[model samples]
Each structure stands twice: as C-alpha cells, then as structure tokens.
Target chain A: MKRLMAIFERDVTLAFRTGGGALNSVAFFALTVVIFALAIGPDRARLSESAAPILWTAATLAAMLSFDRILQADFEDGSLDALIESGDLLSLVALAKASAHWVSTLLPLILATPVLGLLLGLPAHAYFPLMASMVIGTPALSLFGALASALALSLRRASMLITILTAPLLTPAIIFGVAAANAGARGDALFGPALMLLAAMTLFGVLVTPAATAAAIRFNTD
Target chain B: MDERPADAGRLIAARDIAAQRGGRLVLSGVTLAIGPGDLFILRGPNGAGKTTLLRTLAGLSQRAAGALKRSDNASVFLGHADGVKAALTARESLSFWRMIYSAPPAIIERAISRLNIFPFLDQRGASLSAGQRRRLALCRIVISRRPVWLLDEPTSGMDAVSIRAVVDLIAEHCRDDGAAVVATHEPLDFGPGRTIMLDEAA
Candidate 1:
C-alpha cells in the first residue's frame, strides 16, 4: 500500500506540478466542446438529443491525448526501472499510476462536462447522467491506456502509436458509456451496462495490464 | 581483503539465466552468486550482454532460461540514461524519487545537501549538464539507504571529479554492509572489488 501510494503520489505531483498534463486535457476538452458547438450551428433541440454522445466522445479523446505521456516520461528518466527494482507489488504500482492518470486527464474533463453540456443544449437531466457516466467510466480508460503507454515507451513515435494501439480497445468504453448516459437521460435504470462493463474493464485492466507493462519495461530497458 | 563468502553472503543469485533480444541469443546458461559488500564490476564490449545481464540480475529484464533471487529486496538499478525530467527542477526530481522509495524527508534533505546539489536544487534537470544529471540520479540511492545498488554505466558521462564522488558513495555504502553490482567499461579502481568478465562466460 505504501509503495502504491508512493507511485500514485509521484504521478499526481508530476501531472500537476511539472508537465501541466492536466491543463492540456482540460484545454482540449474545452476547445473540443467549443469547436463542436460552433460547427453544429444554433439548432438547440438537435444538440440536446445528441449531447450525451458528443460530450462522451470529446472526453474520451482528451483522455487519450494525455495517456501516452503518463509512462513515457518515467520510462525515459529511469523511474520505471527503479520502481520495478523496489520489490513492491507491480500491480499496486500500476493501479496508483492509473489513478493519477485519471485524476489528471479524466477528472478535469468530467468537471467541465456541465458547461460543455449547457453549450451543447443538454438539459439538466441529460447533463447529470453524462457527468455520472464519465466519473465511473474514465478510470477504466486510464487503466487500459497505461498498458498502451507502457508498450509505446521506447518507440520513436510513441505518442502516435499509443493512439493507434489503444483506440480500438477503447471501443467498449465508448459503447457502454454512451448507452448508460442515454438510458439515464431517458429516466431508465442506468446501472446495467454502464456499471457492469465499466467494472469488467476495470477488472481486466487491473489484472492484465500491469504485468504486461512491467514485462515490457523489462524487455525494452535491456 | 575482507572476502565476504559468495555462498554465505549472497546478495544476488541467478541460476541458468539466459536472455534473447530480437531472436538473437544475448546470454545463455549464465549462473552466479554475488556476495554482500562486494563491488562486482561487469566488463564486456558493446552487444556483449553486459547491460542485459545487469538488467536481468536487477529483475528489470526477462531471463529466458533461469531464476533470480535477491536478498531482503534492498536494491536500486540505475541505467545508462540520466532519468531526470527536463521540466522538473533537480530538487523536484529528487523529491519525487524520495517519495517513490518512501524515504523520509530528512534523509532526502541530507542526500541533496551531501551531493552538493543543494545549490542546483531549484534548477531544472534539462538545464543541468550531463554530469549533474548523473549526480541527481545517484542521490536516490544515497537517501534510500538500501542494502544493494545496481548501476549500469554509472559514470559514463561524468568527469573525474564526479567519478570520484560515485566511488566514494559506493565505498561508504559497502563499508556499512551494503553491496553494489556496477556494470561499467571504465576502470573504477575502488578497493575490495571483483571483476566478472562476460567473455569468460562466452
């Protein structure tokens, strides 16, 4: 737990203090919402119906943009190797890193969703579910994204490769996130697919990605 | 020479450890036990598996054919890269690592001061020279107080003064029952040291 906290805190500190990683995500989220609003014209009713999917899509893209830098910086600087040698539980370390990523990339986007919703003509009911779904779903994005980050650490074009490799895997998050938000907007039970698929993705990410990342770092460092 | 018995005071144990990269055999059937307080220096030419062997022993790389065990989990591995972030100051980098290793604040303060990096603490790592960045990376082990240190090309980019500082730090640690496995091509000339030539295994 201590080591995990250490990794988590380190990532959080880096995200906020050094890289300005969080701000970039927030800016992307805000800019994307603005451009989207401008492009769609003044048809408020159309925008309200489509608001949930649009907001979710923008948030997902913002999160994706920030994921590559999560592990790449650490790998480049030798912290990853040092952490591996620390004899701490690798999964805990991975979880902490993912948590930090979520806080930086996803948290800001989720926080900005209400304003975004208003811009897109979403009602209070629609906006609330969109925000709730984002809160539950973005951590899974962070988890799976970390694997892609680790895999692309040593590549010449890691940023671009991260998108190509992980975007396909992120299809499930998009599908379920859109469904849950839509259901919640329609006054239906949102717990079924929204909660289940997010939980499943979180489980798979926690169990599988860390070992692969640890192994990938081990292979690449040599 | 105070020869800590390799069998009795083993810091690292590898059995039948082999590694491959890009389908090429890097090392095969390699086995060794390094004792406590031993400055085990690795020597080999480029592409000779020196870095691979060090990383595998440090558990940073996959071993194709064997097992590796460490004593008490008291180890830190420093690779060829400086590992400092360009955006973060020297102090921030040290503090970040100190947190990761769970070292107390006092130890971290003492380490930065001891390494003469206190003056440069607020300077970004990107602004520092090659030697200064190396010093920043070394500070973690000093503050960590771990029982073992694993270094790959520790003094690769440093001048003579920085090299001496690294040697002094290693000697102090070994004197306190800590061990170090340093993989370097340069002559380190530290006392009570042993050499592991990869060509011998070849």
Candidate 2:
C-alpha cells in the first residue's frame, strides 16, 4: 500500500506540479468540444443523441495527446534504467506510470465532461452516467497508451506514434461511454454494459500492460 | 537478494558471458570479478561493444548469456541517455526518481544536494546544460545507496568542477563499501582504481 501510494504520489506530482501535459489535455479537450459544437451548430436534438460518444471520443483524443509524457520522460532521463536496475516489480512501476498518466491526461477530460456535455445539449439525466463511465473507463486508455508509448519509446517522435497506436484500442471506451449516456438520457439503467466495460478495461490494463511494457523496455534498451 | 560474502566484498562476477546483437556475437567467453571499494573501468574505442557489455552487466539485455552476482543490496545503471524529461523541473525529476528508487526521503534530498543541483532544482532538465544532466544521472547513485554502480560514460559532458564532483562522489561511494563499473574511453581519475581492458578479452 505504501509503495503504491509512493507511486501514486509521484504520478500525481507530475500531473499537477509540472502542469504541461495535464494542461495540454485540458486544452485539447476544450478544443475538441468547441470544434464539435461549431461543426454541429445549435441543433440540440441531433447533438443530444450523440453527446455521450462525442464527449468520450474527445476525451480519448485529448488523452492521446499526452500518452508519452511519463514513459518517454523516464526513458530519456535514465530513470527507466534505474527502475529496471532496481529489481522492483515492473508491473507496479507500470501501474504507477499508468495511474499518473490517467490523472494528468484523462482525469481533466473527465472533470470537464459536465461542461462539455452541456455544450452537447445533454440532459441532466445523462450527465451523471457520462461522468461515472469516464471515471471508470479512462484508466484503460492511460494503461494501453502507456504500453504503446513504451513500445515506441526508442523510435523517433514516439509520442505521435503512441497516439497512432492507441487511438484504435480506446474505441471501446467511446462505445460504452456513449451507450451508457444515451441509456441514461432515456431514463434507463446503464449499470450493465457501463460497469462491465470499465471493469474489463481496468482488468486488461492491470494484467497485461506491465508485462508488455517490460518487454518493450527491454527491447528498446537492447 | 543474496547475502554478502565475508573478506571478499566482490560486487560483481561474470563467468564466460556471451552476448549477441542482431545475430552477431558482440562479446563471448568474458569473465571478470569486480570487488568492493574498487572502481573498474572498461576502456574501448567507439563501437567496440563497450556499451553492450555494460548493458549486459546492468541486466538491461537478454542478448548476453552470463551469470552476474552483486554483493551490494542494490545495483544502479546509468545508460548513454540523460533520461531526464525536458518538461519536468530538476526537482520534479529527482522526486520522481526518489519514489521509484525505494530510498528514504531524507537520503534522497541529500543525494540531490550532493550533486550541487539544488540551485536549479526547479528548472526543467532540458533547460539545464548537458553537464548538469549528467550530474543528475550521477545523483541516482547517491540516492540509491546501492553498492554496485554500473555507469556508461559518466562524464560525457562536464566542466572541471562537475567532473571533480563526480570523482569525489565515486571516491566517497568506494570508501563506503561501494563498487562501480564505469565504461568510458576518456581518461578518468578515481584514486587507486583498476582498469580492465575489454579489448584484450577477444
């Protein structure tokens, strides 16, 4: 628990203190929603139906903008070498990195969703489920993003490469996020698919990301 | 996590280790033992497999088949890259490393201060010069409290003061039952250190 907190604190510190990656995500999120609003001008009825998915897509893309922040920094700075040298659990290290990425990149997008939803003309009933789904779901994006980022760490302009790889992986989050919102807007229970998608992503992220990252680090370093 | 030996504070032992890169054998039948309080230098020209050998010793590569044993509680490796993020301040970088290193918080601060990086602690690592970045990499040893330091080109870029500081820090680490394997071509001054010519092995 203590070690996990140490990792968590470090991630949080990078997200809130450094402020570059986190702020960029927020700006991207805002831009995405604003552009979306302009593209589909003042048609509340049509926009309302697509609000949940659109908000989630924007969040995923915004999160994509900051995918390489943690691992790439560690890679360039030699901290990744230290981590590999220390004989610490690579899984835990990956988790710490993933946790930080979520806090910095995805958390802000989730926080801004209520406002973004408003821009989409989402009813109040849809807002709660939309926020809840994002809270549970976005960590997977961070985890998978970390994996892709680790895979491309040694390549040129790895951040963009990571973005390209991860955009497809996060499509499920958009699917479930929108489905849950539309279900909520219709006054229906979204607990089924919403919870299952979030749980599946979390489990997949936790189970697979670390080992992939370890292999990627070894390969890149080699 | 093996127990330390008595009388022979050998930090690293490699027996007939063979390593290959891209199906090409880089190092083969290499055997050496590095003892505590000893600074071992691996001297070779560029592309002479120096970094590959160092990376193998640091456990960063599976390309090598070797058994390496360390007497220290932990081992730390500093690769060719500086590894500091351009976006994070020096302090933030140190703090991030501190968390991952499993060192006590107070010791971490002392390590940071020891590098004389306290002044520019808040500055982004990219903003710092190449020499300062190297110093930050060196600080990991101080923070790690590990007995074995595997350093690849520890003094790539530095002024006289920073280089002296590195020498002093290595000397101090050796004095305190620590050992280091430094791979470099440049002449280094670590008092009473041994040089293992890697070129002679093949």
Candidate 3:
C-alpha cells in the first residue's frame, strides 16, 4: 500500500511539473471545445443542443492526448524496470499510474467543464449531469487508455496506436455520457439509467484493466 | 579461479542458460554461480550479449533456455538508462525511490553522501551530468537493500573519482554479504571477483 501510494504520488507530481502532460491535456481539451464551437458557428440553440456530444468528444480526445505518455515515458527512462524490480505487484503499479492519470488529467478536465459548458451554451440543467457523467465515466477512459498505452509501449508511432486501440473501447462511455447529459437537458427520467450504465462501465474498467495493463507492460519490457 | 563449486548456499546458479534478443539467439551455453560476497564482472565486445545476460539475470528478459535458480528472489538491476525523470529534481527522485523501497531515512542519507550527490540534489534530472544521473540511479540499489545487484555498465560515464566511489560502494556491498554481477567495457577494480567473458560463453 505504501509502495502503491508512492507510485501514485510520483506520477502525479511528474504530471504537474513543468512541461508535463496534465497542462497539455487541459489546454487541448479547452482548445478542442473552442474549435468545435467556432466550426459549428454562433447559433445558440444548435450549440446548446450539440453541446453534450461535443464536450464528450473533446474530453475523449484530450484524454487520449495524455495517454501516450503514461507508460511510454517511464519505459523510455527505465523507470518501468525499476518499478518492476521494486517487488510490488505490477498490477498495483499499473493501478497507481491509472489513478494518477485520472487525478492529474481527467479531474482537471472535469473542473474546466463548466467554463467550456458556458462557452458551448450548454443548457443550465445539463451542467451537473455532464460533469457527473464525466466524473463517473472518465475513469474508464484513464484505465483502458492506460491499458492501451502499456500495450503500445516501445512501439514506433505509439500515440497513433494508442488512439486506434483505445477509441473503440471508449465508445460506450461516450454513448452513455452524452445520453445522460442530453436527458438532463430535457429534464427527463432517462438521465438515471444512462448515468447508471456509465458508472457500471467505469466500475468494470476499474476492476479489470490494471491487471491486463500489467501483463502488457511485462510483455513489452520483456 | 574458474572452477565451479558444488551446489551449496549459492545465491544464484544457472546452467546451460540461453537468452534471445529480438528473436535471435544472442547468448547460449552459459553456466555460472553467484554466492554471498561474490562480485562477478562480465566482459565482452559490443553485441557480445553482456547487457542481454545481465538483463536475463535480472528477469527483465526471457531466458530462451536454462536451468536457473535463486536462493533469494530479491535483486536490483541498473540498466543503461539512468531511469531519472527529467522533470524531477535529484532530491525528489531519491525521495520517490525511498518511498518505493520503503527505505529508512538513514539509508537514504548514507546513499546520498556516499555517492556525493548532495551538491546536485536540487538539480533536475535533465540538467544533471551523466555521472550525476548514474549516481542517482545507483542510490536505488543501496536503498533497495536487495541481496543481488545486476548492473550493466554502471561506471560508463564516471570520472576517476566517481568511478572510485562506485568501486568502493560495490566492494562494501559484497563485504556485507550481497552479490553483484556487473557488465562493463571499462575495467573496474572490484577486488577478488570472478570474470565472465561472454565471447567465451558463446
């Protein structure tokens, strides 16, 4: 447990350091939202109506932008080897890394969602549901994205491979996240079911991906 | 000096070991034993599989074929990469490793002082010279308190003084009943140890 916390703390510290991945991800998230608003033009109703999908898409892409470095940097620098030699279960290390990604990358994006919400003219009622969806849903992104990152470690064009490997797996979270937000926008009862399913997916990802990621990391390093 | 001992209290023993790199057999038909207070130096030309052999022993690479055994499973491996994070200061790196190993503060202080790392403790890994980075990486081995050390080119970029420090550290480690297998091109004076020539292993 102490070792796991050490891994988590170190990764989060690294993420917040100068030129770290956290800032880049948040910038990418905000920029992506702004670009979508501009491309779709200034029609308020249209912007509000498309807001949930746009935010979810931008968040997903921004999450991917940070995923590539999660394990690749450690692998490149030989920290992965050191961690493996530390005698802690690799799955616990993977879990710590994924948790750090969630905290350093996804949490900041969630915090910025409100501002981006205002920019997109997201319906006032939908804000809570959108944030809640991301809060519950994005762990899946970090977990599975970390799995992809570990699987893609040491490969050339690894980021591209991470995106390709992670996109399909994340589709369900986007579907459920966008659905919950839209339902909240309409003040409908469907919000409950959509959010529940989103939570379920995130919970499942939390349970499973770390071990698989550990296996991938071991294979790659070998 | 080259005779194998009968199996008794060996820290590590491998017979007819083979290791592959990139699906090609790079090292094969190797046999050796390491016991407490042992320091085995591996020497070979480039591509002679010295790194591969160290990595295989460290369990970082799969052994293609071998009967390998270890009396104790704990070992620390220092590879070519220093494993220092560019964004982290040297002190931060040491503290982070301290947490990973759950090492006592006194041990960390000893490592920092022994490696002469206090002068650059606040410098980020990106700014540290090669020798400094190597020193930081070596601290992990001390903090680890593992029974075996597998080091690949540990003194690669050190000046004479730093090299002497590392040699003393390794000697101290062996004197404390720890075994070390160091693979290096430069001849280091690790007193009273066996040498494994990888070219001869092949």
Q: Which candidate achieves the best TM-score against the true structure?
A: 3
DockQ order of candidates, top first: 3, 1, 2
Of candidates 3 and 1, the better by TM-score = 3
- For each model, chain A TM-score? 0.93, 0.92, 0.97
**What DockQ does candidate 3 score?**
0.77
Best by DockQ: 3
TM-score of predicted chain B versus true chain B for each candidate: 0.89, 0.88, 0.93
Clashing pairs in 2: A76-B83, A77-B82, A77-B83, A77-B84, A78-B83
* Global lDDT of each candidate: 0.78, 0.76, 0.89
| Model 2 chain B: lowest-lDDT 10 consecutive positions | B1-10
Compose the digit string of candidate 3's lDDT tens values, residues A1-222.
998998999899999998787988999999999999999999999998998999999999999878987898899889999998788889989989999999999999999999999998887788998998899999999999999999998795588789989999999999999999888778889999999999999889878998999999988998
Pull out the clashing pairs in model 1. Answer: A77-B83
TM-score of every candidate relative to the true structure: 0.89, 0.88, 0.96
What DockQ does candidate 1 have relative to the true complex?
0.56
Report the C-alpha lDDT of model 1 over B10-96, residue by residue, as the tens digit. Answer: 778777789876557788887877666767788877887887887777767777887777666757778887778787888877777
Please list the residue runs of candidate 3 whose C-alpha ends up more than 4 Å from where it truly belongs after superposition: B1-8, B71-73, B200-202
Ordering by lDDT: 3, 1, 2
Assess candidate 3 and give its lDDT.
0.89
Q: Which interface RMSD values do the candidates have, in the order shown? A: 2.3, 2.8, 1.0
lDDT of 2: 0.76
